[model samples]
Target: MNKFHGIFKQLFELQLPGTEALDLYEGYYAQLYEALTSRDNYDIPIVMEQARITGGPVLELASGTARIVKHIANAGYSVTGVDISDDMLAIARKKTEMLPQRIKKNITLHKGNMIDFQVDEQFALVILTATSISLLKDEEEVECMFNNIYEHVKDGGRFVFDLLDDESFENSSLRMGGIDAITLNQSPIPKQFILMGEQRDANHSKRALMNFYSEVIAEDRTYRFFGSTEKTYFQYDAILPIIKKTGFKIIQIEKKELAKNEMIYMFVLEK
Candidate 1:
């Protein structure tokens, strides 16, 4: 990766451990939910609605912010949410506080690695929502993670996940464009944040590099962001074969016709 990409990745991956990642997310959690949920014809609710099918134990892998977990819990289902980032979980725990008493009692939270979270009891339904399953760093990790999910789900139970179809990326690649400059002044520690540049090709993949230069006024410390490309690109076609080899079956798909750019498909596999 180029210097800009490397720096972008570092900022996202490392600063979250010590900086305003958790605090910033906690502050804006509800607002983020409202903006994302209000978008018309989103399929997340469809997956959350499906979680009610058995009313049995439901485990959401990589459950960031727990927005769906809160909804599933409120609907009277036993839910357990697990995520890799403590920063994310911190915000998620705070959000769960808004849930009703009975639902709050039914929901449990665990912090662990997504590819290898250990649990004795099998769940009736296993879900990885909001394109989280695609976050695995590579194809090998993806296969292993899916295998792990397969092991955790009970027989006949379903594994649900959503992704933007590859064709969407293919189409968008042609429109490959850059972002306008915008300042994010939310951090107590000032950051010079910019979407430096982007490279989206016609075939399938797109790459965008973001830069964050933070100065912590109180601590007299300055650290360069460790990560690069806040938004990485992927081809859904490249991901599907890996999903199939991991023994998953595609059961239902929700294609957004209004905005083809926002197509989200749900993959359900029976174990």
Candidate 2:
């Protein structure tokens, strides 16, 4: 496995330590869904289309926290949500366990890396949304990852993903400078969260150094945790070639405006 897959594999390896490190991820994952679903729906109609095409089972890659999975299941489709986060999966399991029997009967949660996860049966559609594809760090791995998705999807099945636009990628990289912080209201205990991103490459492409920090205030003690992740973005101009190299024909590229004056693109593909 490559470094990207390796990181996810380590994140999902079944163990308590795996769960502990993932606690932070679980918090963010839930917060993300709460924030997104509260305003604009994220791919609800697209997912509903997939549900209709399959007539039943849908496979979701990098399905963090089962937010979308629960929605898919509630819509009457059987869903298998796969993610490489034991911490996230632990919370997913608990949430699913608490569901009514009807919903619980149609959902399955698994610990698997996105690049290598497989099941005995082929799916009608496979989806990677919310820039989950961005998690893979570079081009070679991106190619490998797409190939894996193509391999797993059925002959007539469709693959879908959402990402930033190429033009936007260029525009942002040129004037990249920002420091924005977010605070999540839902926490196990009182906490303050801050994410500061510094733009590095300002020409050709978009690249940013994302620094994440969280301050937790327990009853008597205060703790701080910090980590950094680098995001290197691509334009649609640069990305289509890579998608074609893996035999994925881009069926549609839809763009929509977000509340924050950002345009998002969704790429729909088929084998």
Candidate 3:
């Protein structure tokens, strides 16, 4: 397993309406989300490539901190980002404020859910990046998102997303302890992010009851974060049936390796 792998993306909250981290740390969690996502930008470049295909508007689900949204807009694409977390949207809005007026005007942030969002017009490209889809409660939510994404996608447009493949899930036991559990610390500022997580069997074998207890020590301040959720774990062969049932038709699927034992399944689908 990648040592810092867990630390980098571990802060991903289950979904919108925010999490206990916000209540405990107030604006602190949003800042951390920006810091972590800004540091790696796990999949922004690939998402931008998709944005380039259609010179039309783009919509991104779970667009936390508007990290991807800002990048796309800076590239001269109009982007509408929808996310549920107020803390995150606030940061996204704040960050865009400093951009050149032209770029700033190209980005829009909406406070909403990925499962059911309303927009008058459809987009030429729809994206769900950063493996945020994994936070969906179950296959049903996944379908709900797909169905909604289908509605938003224009004819001949595409849907692109990546999932952390289940290849490494069998080793969850090795990561269940605490922040003491994983470390990929290379930050210049002394940082302390403790993720207290455990993986346990859910109602279904491919789902896990995830418990989160996190604490963060910033460069000069200390904060605590917390949350609990039951999230779907994906295995390609096992979930293929679910995807096949969606309105989208898979056009291409590929795998990208980030670190040892860490692989992401990137899927491109057409409406």
Candidate 4:
């Protein structure tokens, strides 16, 4: 029976929804996303700390699952989270339902594209963390996003975000592999996942193809595999001009080492 159940599970996960342009995190995958990322994303507290220093109403673009937005709201800032994924927004709303009234009242989630979103009021602090700015497919898209971010910020307000440094990606291996575990609702039945991937430069563009295969193993030792391929392009020199053209003045750009083999670039911009 366990063998049969595993087979069914594999088939289900194999059919999970995704597109060349976007990955749809719904149903079982939604649960998996929550399980994988519910922990303190070090970026959350970092952004929250900045928000406290800068003051708010704050805005977070591509705010997946409200992980960071929730922290800002709970820290007593009014925050708005915007994303294009209904599945992600659904999970965020469900989680918000359990928050205290004060915190719940402080957070607002909107379904919109980051390149073209509008709000009634401007914010003192705007952020896009966790390398989400890489999701824009090209320079034109990045310009549009920066323009929107510019319009959303109050004069002298700060815009904060993180991205992969060009040197890190240029020096990275073409292929890599890793393993991680996802514990569902703190249940003992942990799901082990593996990632194996390669990166290749895209033709005539600074963008590159990030292709990967992922396998998730169930408690019964049954497993499923999912594949993803996306375009990512962000270089400090390439992006800085766009930010300046969109009316942002660079305040600081710093490199932080997270691990022996991993590093990130943080940007602070002012309008």
The TM-scores, one per candidate, come to: 0.70, 0.79, 0.79, 0.79
lDDT of each: 0.62, 0.67, 0.69, 0.70
How well does candidate 3 match the true structure, expressed as C-alpha RMSD?
6.6
Per-residue error at 114 for model 1, in Å?
1.7
Per-residue lDDT tens digits for candidate 1, residues 68-91, read 787778878888999876767776
- Candidate 3 lands at a TM-score of 0.79
Residue 10 error, candidate 4, Å: 16
Candidate 4: C-alpha lDDT: 0.70
Candidate 2 residue-pair clash tally: 2
How many residue pairs collide in each prediction?
12, 2, 1, 0
- Candidate 2 lDDT for residue 255: 86
Q: Could you give me the TM-score of model 2 versus the true structure? A: 0.79
Pairwise lDDT winner, candidates 1 and 4: 4
Q: Alpha carbon lDDT of residue 45, candidate 3?
A: 70
lDDT of 2 at 46: 77
Model 2: residue 71 alpha-carbon error in angstroms: 1.0
lDDT of 4 by residue, 1-271 (tens): 1111222234444565431112435444555566667774657656766787789899999887888888898989999999887888998999998999999999999998988988888999999976777777888988988888888899889999888775675325432322223333344336544343434443434454443233444555544444343546477788878887898998877777654344678888988
Write model 2 residue lDDT over 1-271, tens digit each, in one string: 1211222333334332212222334555444444434344557677677667656677898887777788888888888999987777777788789999899898998898887777777777888886777666667767887888888778877887878664664436533555567775454655555544444544424554444444555576654444345556666676789998999888888887655556668887887
For residue 97, give model 4's deviation from the true position in Å: 1.1
